[model samples]
Target: MREIKILAVVVVLTLITYWGVEPFAHSQMHPHVDPANYDFAQADKVSAKEQVDEKKEALEKAEAQAKATGNEKLTHIPKSEYNEAVKFEKTINDFWASNKEALSLTGNATNGATLVQANCTACHSIKKEGFPPVMDDASSAAAYGVVPPDLSTAGKLYSKEYLVGFIKEPTLASKVSHKFVDGRVHPMPSYSWMQPQEIADMVAYLQSIAPDKMTDKEVFQNACQRCHGIKYGDMLGGTMAAHTPETNIKAYMGKVPPDLSQYIRSRGAQYLHEFINDPQKHLESTAMPRVGLTKDSEEKVISYLEKVGDSKKAQREELGPKFLIYLVIFAIFAWLWKASKWRDVH
Candidate 1:
C-alpha cells in the first residue's frame, strides 16, 4: 500500500511536469509558430489576390477624389493603374498555372548552347563547360555590384519556373519588386523579349551538364554562398565564391550578410525555411532576395545547416533512449528496495 502511494505521487508529479509545467515553460520560451507553407503556387495566388484588392482600393480612393474635387481626369490615372494591376495578376496566374506544361515542352540543348553563349556568357560563366566570365571577379563585381553565379549548377539549384521568371523579369521573379521601383532597376536586366522556347532551351542546356545529385554542402554553396558566408571553422574555404572577397559582397549588399554558421541553432529551422522562401515576408525591405530553391533543395540546405550547427544532434538522439531505459530500471530497483525496508516497519 505504501509503495503504491509513493508510485502514485511520483506519477502525479511526472504528469504535472509533462502536461502542465513543461508546456507552459515552452510556451513562454518558444511560442508556437505556424509551419511554413511551401506551396509556391498557393502563395502566388494569395499575392495576386492581395495585389488586385490593393488596386481596387486605390481605384475607390481615386473615385472619391474625383467626386470631391470635380476633376474627372484625376480618376483616369487610378483607372489605368487598376487595369494594369489586373492584367499583371492574370499574367502571373497564367504563368504559374501553365508552368509545368511549359517546362515539359522538349528543348534543343544544341541551340540552347548557342543561345547561352550569345546572351548569357557576357555576365555569367559556365565553369563546367570551360566558359569563364568575360571579366574577372573583381571587374564584374565592380560593374554589376555582385559577381554573377556560374551557371554550372544553377539548373540543379533552382526551379524551372523560377529560372524562367528570373530570366523574364529579374526584379519580379526575385520578389524584390517592392525595393526596385520608380525607375530603379535590378542588376540583371529583363529578357522579356526572348521567346519562351529560347528560355526553355537555355534551361535544358544547363540541366544537361549539371550533375544528377549534389551534396548538401554543394547545394548551399550554389544557392547561398554568393551572398552569405559560413564562417564556422574552415567552412568558408569550401564555398564556391570564397575567392570573391567578403568586402566586395558587403559593399554590394549595403551590409555584410550574417554568417550562417550558427543560424540553424539561433533562428530555428521554421523561420529559416519561410525566410528563404520569401525574405520580404519576414523582414520587409530586406536586400536579400528570394532564393527560389525548390522544396527538395531547400530541405537539403537546411540539412547541411543542421550538420554544421548541431554536430552533436545524432549522438544526443542515440543516447536519449538508453538514458530513459536506465532510469526506468533504476526506478524499479528503487521501488523494490523501498518496499523491503517498509515491509519490516509495517
Candidate 2:
C-alpha cells in the first residue's frame, strides 16, 4: 500500500513537472502562433494561392458584368487591406534598417573570429584539412543524413540580410531552393530566444569569412558530401565511394554522421547557416560541431539542402501551437484524474 502511494506520488509529480515546466519552456523558447489572435480553422480555410485565385475569378466576373452593362466603375481591392500590407512592409523594413546599422557599428571580422571560437567551433569546422574534435562524418551521416559542412567561404554566397534573418529565427528563415509543397517539420532547433545582438555578431563573423567565389553545388560537394550523400546518383560519374566506411568513422568519433538529404526541408537555409556558424551556443553539449562557414558558403549549402530536404517547413512549424494546446488539455485531464484517484490516500 505504501509503495503504491509512493508510486502514485511519483507519477503525479512527474506529470506535473512536464505539465508545468516543459510546456512553459516550450512556449517561452519556441516560436508559436499568437494564442490570442490565431484561429487554426480560419487559417486553414484558404491558402494564399487559393485566395488569390478566388479574387481573380471574382474580378473577371465583375469585368464581364461591367462590359455587358456599359458601367466603367473601377474595381479595386479594399484600400485598407493595401494600407495594412504596406504598413507591415514598412515596419519590417525599418526593423531591418535599425538592426543593420547596429550591426555595422558592432560587427567586424576580427571580433567575429573571437566570437566564433567561443560559440561556434564545437559543431562547425572552418577548414577542410583537420578533423573536428568530436563526431565525424560517418557517425553524423548515420544520424542526421550528413555531417556538418565546412564553412571556409560562406560570406560570398549569402546576403547579409539573409544571414541576419536566419540568425534571428532559423526555422522561420527563407529557403534558397524549392518551396515546400507538403507539410513537414524541420529538425533544426530555434535559437531566437537568445540575445538578438549576439546573433548579429555571429552573422558578421560569417560574412567576414566568405570567399570571393564558390558555387552552391561546389560548396555542398566539397564541404558536405563527405558526410551527406546527394541521391542524384554518382555526381562524380561513379568514380568515388558514396559514403565512408563506419569503421573509418569509429576510429575517430565513435559515431556516424547524419544524412543531410532533406536538411533544407527540415532546417531551412537561415537555420542551417546559423547552426553551421554556431551549434553549441544554441544546443549545449550537442554532438555536432561548428563548421566555421561564411554567410555565402552557408547559403550555398542550404540551397542544396532545400533541393533535397522537406519543403513545407513553414507549414509544419505552424502546427506547433496545436500540439501544445493538445498537451495542455491532456495535462489538465491527467491532473484531474490524479486528484480523484488519490483523494483518500493521504
Candidate 3:
C-alpha cells in the first residue's frame, strides 16, 4: 500500500512538473486562433493549447491510473518529439565549416554544387537515371506524394536566378519554373524561404547541372518522384494559410510561418527578413515563430531573396543581390526588432 501511494505521488508530481516547470523555463504559446495578442513566453510550453481538452482528459486518466495502481498507462497523452527532430541548429552551423572550401556557397557556384550533391541529393534526386526516391511523407519522398525534380537538368529548364528565386519563394515558381503545374504537398514544404547560403549552393548546383547527364523529362520525374505532387500546396492553399499559427506555423512549415508565396507578393524582401527574425513585431496576427537563425544563415537567406520575387524567367537569372545584400539593407530593421524584443523583457 505504501508503495502504491508513493508511486501515486510521483506520478502526480511528474504531471505537475510538465505543467509548471516546463512552462516557466521554455515556452511561447499564443492562442491558436488569435495570432495577435499572443504570448511569446510559451515557445517551450508543452501544453498543447490547441487541443486543451484532450490533454486535460489525458491528465485525468493518469491521475486515475495512479490512484488505482502504481503503474502508468497514460497512452493518450502526447508529449513533444523534439528529441526525434534533426537538430538543424547545430548541423546548419557545422555545415559551413564542413564544406568550407569544397562546394562552399560562401565563395562561388562550383563549390556550392559539391555541397548540394553531398547534402541535398540524398533527400532529393534530380536525375531520372539517378533515382533518389519519392516524397511520401515517410522515409521515401512518396510519403508526401511529391516527385523531386532533376537538378541535373534544372539548369537548362531554368536559369541560376530562376533557381535561386524558386528556393527563396518556391510558390513563386508558377512564374519561375518550367512546370506550370502546382506540385507540392502539406509535408513537401518549400526550402526557398529557408537559410539563404544553402539556397545559393543548391541554386549553384542546379546551374552547374548538365543536360547531357540526363533527359529533362526523366530528370523531372526522378527529381519530383520522391516528393508529393504540385497540388499539395494549392489544395490546402487558403485553409492552411488561415489556419491557427499553432496548427499551421511550424506544424506544416518550419518553425516560421508560410508567407513567402503570399506575403512577399505584397511586402518586399526587407519585410520578409524582418518578419523571419521577428514575426510578432511586424504583424500582430502572425503565427510565425523565429528559429534563431545564425548570422550566416540570415545573411545567406537575405541574399537568396532577390531570386524569389521575380515574375519573369523560368530558369537561371540573377534576381536580388547576393546573400549579404538583404542583410545590409535590413540590418537596421533587425536591430530595431531586437530592441523591441529586449524592451518587452524589461
Candidate 4:
C-alpha cells in the first residue's frame, strides 16, 4: 500500500511537471501565430495560370514599345515604358507574397525546356541518371583548373526563388572574392538580360523535371558532391580526391574542406545559411567562398538535412501525448488495486 501510494505520488508529480512545462517548452520551440491575422486561404483562391498570363501580356507590351524605340537594351528603354514593366513585376511580387507556395507551383515546363536547351545546355546538363560528364571534365579542369558542377539534380537541390535570383545574377550569387585566380575570376555570367517570362519558364521546367520530392541525398550531391563523399548503397560516390592530394585543394582554396554529411545536424540551418552566404563572416580567412544562396535555397537545404538527421521527429512528437495518457491510466489502475487490497485490513 505504501509503495502504491508512493508510485501514485510520483505519477502525479510527473504529470504536473509535464503539463506545466510542456506548453512553455513548445511555445519557445515553435511560436504560434493567430491564423485569423493571415489570409492563408487566399493562396488557393489565386489562379497561377491567370497570374502567368497577365505577366506575359505586360512583358509583351513593354517589349513592343522597346522595339519601336530601336533600343537593344531593355535598360535603355524610356522611363514611361519601363514603369509599365516595373508595375507588372510588382503585381506578381505582391501576389506571390500572399501566396508564397504559388511561385514554385506555377511555371510552364515545356517552354522552360526550350529556353534551357538554348541558354543553359552550353554549361549545365540535365541528365542525372549516371555520372556521365556533360562536358569534357578533363579539358575543363585543364583550362579552368576545376570542372564545373553538373545541374542535373538542381531542381531538387535548390528552391525556385533562389534559382530565379541566381539565374539573374550568378556573380552576385557566388560572391567570389576578387583575389580568386584562374577561371574562378570568370565564373558563370549573369543572365539578367532574359525576360521575366523566360526566367519563370526555366524555373518551372526545372521543378517539373526535378524529383517529386527532395531528399538529403540530392541536397548533398548538388552542393557538396564536388568536395565531399559519402557511401550510397554499394557504390562509394562523390569526389574521393576531395581531401587527399592536399596540394590540389591548397592550390585553389589553401585547405581541404571538411565533409558535411553531418554538418546540418551540428551547425544548424541558420548557421549554414550564414556560412553559405558568406563564409568569411563566421571564420575569417577561411578557404570556403560565399555561395550566395538565397533564402529559399537555404530553406530547401535545411529541409533536406532534417530528413537525413531527424526523419522520425514528427512521428515522435505526435505520439508524446498518447504516451503520457497511457502512463496516467496505468497509475490509476495501480492505485485502485492497492485500495481494494487494503479494504479488508482497514
Candidate 3 lDDT over residue span 46-95, tens digit each: 11232344545556667687668866544333222221122322332243
Clashing pairs counted in every model: 0, 45, 66, 0
lDDT winner between candidates 1 and 2: 1
Q: Whose TM-score is higher: candidate 1's or candidate 3's?
A: 1
Worst 10 residues of 1 by lDDT: 234-243
Instruction: List residue ranges in candidate 1 displaced over 4 A.
Output: 1-39, 50-104, 234-247, 325-346
lDDT of 2: 0.53
lDDT per model vs. reference: 0.79, 0.53, 0.42, 0.57
Cα lDDT for residue 24, model 1? 100
Give the TM-score of each candidate: 0.73, 0.37, 0.27, 0.47
Task: Give the lowest summed-lDDT range of ten residues in model 3.
Answer: 37-46
Candidates sorted on TM-score, descending: 1, 4, 2, 3
lDDT of 2 by residue, 53-95 (tens): 5456666776677778887463344333344344534434444
Winner of 3 and 4 under lDDT = 4
Kindly list the per-residue Cα lDDT of model 4 for residues 201-315, writing each as its tens digit. 8888777777765554555456654654432221232322332233444455556666554566677666676566555445644666544343444566666555655566689
Deviation from native of the Cα of residue 65 in model 1, angstroms: 19
lDDT of 3 at 245: 29
Superior candidate under TM-score, 2 versus 4:
4
lDDT of 1 at 108: 81
